[model samples]
Target: RLRAGVVMLIDLLSSVPSVVFGLWGILVVAPAITGVYTNISSALSGVPVLRTVFSGAPISGRSFFTAGLILAIMITPIITSITRETFATVPRAQKDAAYALGATNWEMIRGSVLPFSRSGIVAGVLLGFGRAIGETIAVALVIGSSPQITQRLFSSGDALSAVIANQFGESTGTYQAALIGMGVLLFVITLVISAFARAMIARAERRIGAESV
Candidate 1:
């Protein structure tokens, strides 16, 4: 419930310009962290700090966390809207039935209601995942734009969408083909995940129907 409400708020917030968020991340949040990191180093050193504060601020252009976070910002609104719609679709009669059976709100949501709407929720989530995977400009602006992969949230890395966004214009024939190939790979992955989610949803629906009958 907490997460849903937060996602709802973020979704509402995200309807604003993504560039605004990107720029805000760049100008404000980045500086604060850079200052903190630099200050920690300066404090540890006994000698007076020669390097200017944040003069060599980390580029912070790309990292897995940065890309994921930017994409999350872009997709929050979409996911929240989809979730709201899915929840709305739950039949009033079914909810009332659960209530009559002495089910609490959480119980009703956990049992009768969720099972019926599970497929739609899964569908919505898969769509949101796809949207996150495809976001470009917002991610490009903040992602350190690095090609190498690293596990650290602070390290820079690029996603397929970010790479395409960064290099497509300058790309020549073979480079463009390579970019297209990356797109194809992403498309394939998305398609597979969607198909799997749909299949699982279908199986769950069938199981629920059987159990109910």
Candidate 2:
């Protein structure tokens, strides 16, 4: 239920200018994390605290996770809508049959709704992922524009979108060509991933149909 809400919100929010969310994420979530603790070194005392709890504590802003979370918020609605619509198409008879067999709600969902709607869910998720991958202005602002990957969720890192968005304006000649090439690469990668997801979903549907028969 919470996830669904996030999805719906994200879909609506994402349609908003990427700049808006980017600014909002940077201003809101980033500062929220920053205010929680001074730094990881201070938070992680010399003592051997439980790895999970210590790791879970907040730190700085502009981290990779923050960027991903912000991106998720932007894309959730698209995924949720697609997933909801997909699930809606599942035959009522299938759900009724499961319920008649004394299946719990979870069981009905898992066995009937999930299997039947797997393709749609996969497609939705893949589309969301693509949106995240290509997101530019919003991610640029929240992601701190750092080029390197970091272990900290709050530590900044650059994404392809950020790099492109940042550099494209100043680039010329070969540099421009290179930037465009990067975009081409991104396009190809997304297309390949989308294709793979579609194929996988198709295969899953076929397998489920065969098993049901």
Whole-model lDDT, candidate 2?
A: 0.76
* TM-score for each model: 0.68, 0.76
The digit string of per-residue lDDT tens for model 2 on 1-213 reads: 997776666567646887888888888888786655345535665547433233433344766767877888888777878778777767788999999999999999999999788877888899778777888888888777777655555566788878998999999999899989999998888888778767866766676567567
lDDT per model, in order?
A: 0.68, 0.76
* Tens-place lDDT digits, model 1, residues 1-213: 997788668767767776777776666655556556456445645544433321233555334545566667676676666566667766687889999999999999998777777776777678778767766666777777878755445555667887987898899999999999998888898888778766755765575557556
The list of candidate 1 runs beyond 4 A from truth reads 1-14, 32-62, 188-213
For model 2, which pairs clash? 7-76, 7-77, 11-77, 63-154, 63-155
Number of the top TM-score candidate: 2
